[model samples]
Target: MRGPRRLRLPRTRAGWRRLTQAVAAGCVLALLPPTWLYVTTGGRAGTVAGAPRTDVAVVFGAGLWDGEPSPYLAHRLDAAAALYRAGRIEVVLVTGDNSREDYDEPDAMRTYLVRHGVPDARIVSDYAGFDTWDSCVRAKEVFGVDRAVLISQGFHIRRAVALCRAAGVASYGVGVADRHDVTWYYGAVRELFAAGKAALDVTFEPDPRFLGPKEPGVRRALADAGRRPAAPLPRDAGR
Candidate 1:
C-alpha cells in the first residue's frame, strides 16, 4: 500500500466525530415538524393518548408486494377486526394504493379480514384511496361515512385526525401497538415530512384521481322494491 498513500483520509477520531454530528443533525431535522405541530396545536399533534372510540375503523394500507399484504398492513387490519368484534366500530374501510397493473391492496385487506372471521358484508374496499386524505374524502362522498376510527401507528394518527377535521369528519384513531425492536428509523424520518404534508391536506381539497369517475356513496339496495327506475327488483310485487 505504498507509504500510507500520502495520508488522504481524516484521522480516525475526527472522522467518527463528524459522523456522529451528521447523524444527530439528521435526527433533529426529522423531529421538527411533528414537534412544531404539537407545540403549535397545543400539544394535540401526535397520537391521542387514549382516543375516544368511533363508528367505522378505516384501515389504511401500509405496503404490499406481488399481491400479498405486508405485516404492517396486517396489523392495521387486525386492529380493525378487533374493534369490530368489540363493537367499537360498525364497519371497516380498507384504503390503499393500487396504481400498478397487477397489485390490489383493498382486496388483499378484504381477504385478510374475511379469513380472520370478520363477515364479508361488514367490509368495504375503496379502490382509489391512495392516501389518507383520499380515504377521508371518499368516506363522505362515496361511502357515506360520517364518523370513523383511523388506524395506524402512534406517531401517524395525529396528522390523520387533523386531516379528518379538515374534511368535516367526526373521527378518532386507533393506534396499533408496535414491537419496540422493529426497525422504523426510515419511516420515522419520513413521517415528519408526512406530518407537514398532512397539515396541507387539511386545508387543501386536492382532487383525488378516482373522484370524478368513481362511484363513492352507497347505492341503495334495490330501493325497497319498485320505487326508482334504477332499482333492480322485479316490477310487480308490491306496486
Candidate 2:
C-alpha cells in the first residue's frame, strides 16, 4: 500500500497571499538587528579630530583610480593620516582587497598615507581584506589587534564598527563626512543591504578567506609607534 498521502501547503490564491506575507514578515525580522546596529552605532562614530586615541586606526578600502586611491579612499586615508599625525592612534592598519595581482588596495592606501606624512613604519598592510568581514576577522585573527578605531565614510562606519567588534576587536569609529553629492547618495543606498549582510556574517562567524599564522605585525607597528599593545581577546569571544 502507498504511504500516507504527503502533506501539501495551501495552494489557493488566498493561501499564496498569506504565505507571501509571512515570508515578507520574516525578511523584515531578519533585518531588524542590522537596522538597530545602524542606529545604536551612531554615537560611536566621531571625527578624527575628536576621537579617542587607540593602538591603531583600521582604514577600510573603498576603491582605486589609476593605481591611486579614489577620492573616497583618499578621504579615508586623509582622516587616518590626520589622526596619526595628531597622535590619536599609534599605528594605521590599511586593510583592503588585494586578491588580484594587478589591483592592490593596501599598497595604494599606504602610499597615500606616506605621501600625506604618515611614517611608513607605522603603516601595516593587510593584503587580504577582500570585504568588511574579512578585514575585521583578519585584524584580530592574523594581525593581533585588540582595540582599534575604524575609519570610513559616515554611511559605512557603523557597519564596520559592528563587524569588527563581532570579530573580536574592541572598536570605535571615525566617520569621514560624506561629500553629499553622488558619492554620498551611492554609499547611503548601498549601506542598507551591507548592514544586513554584516548582521548575517556576524551570526554565522564565517572564517576569513585567508587566515595564516598569527604575526607580530600589529604589535610591532604599535611598539614602533611608541604604544604598548593591548592583550587581544579570544578570536571568537565577541561573536
lDDT of 1 at 17: 88
After superposition on all C-alphas, the RMSD of every candidate to the true structure, in Å, is 10.4, 6.6
lDDT of 2 by residue, 167-235 (tens): 988788889986699878988888877877888898898998888888788788777767854444222
The true-versus-predicted C-alpha distance at residue 1 of model 1, in Å, is 26
TM-score, one value per model = 0.70, 0.83
Top candidate by lDDT? 2
lDDT of 1 by residue, 1-239 (tens): 45665655556998978988999999897676687555433322223334334446678888885678887788778877777676555567788877877888988999999998787776778888888888778777777765566788765666666666566566566667676544456666677889777767665778667764445323321122122222111111110
TM-score, structure 2 vs. true: 0.83
On TM-score, the candidate that comes out on top is: 2
Model 2, stretches more than 4 Å misplaced? 1-33, 39-42, 228-239
lDDT of 1 at 119: 73
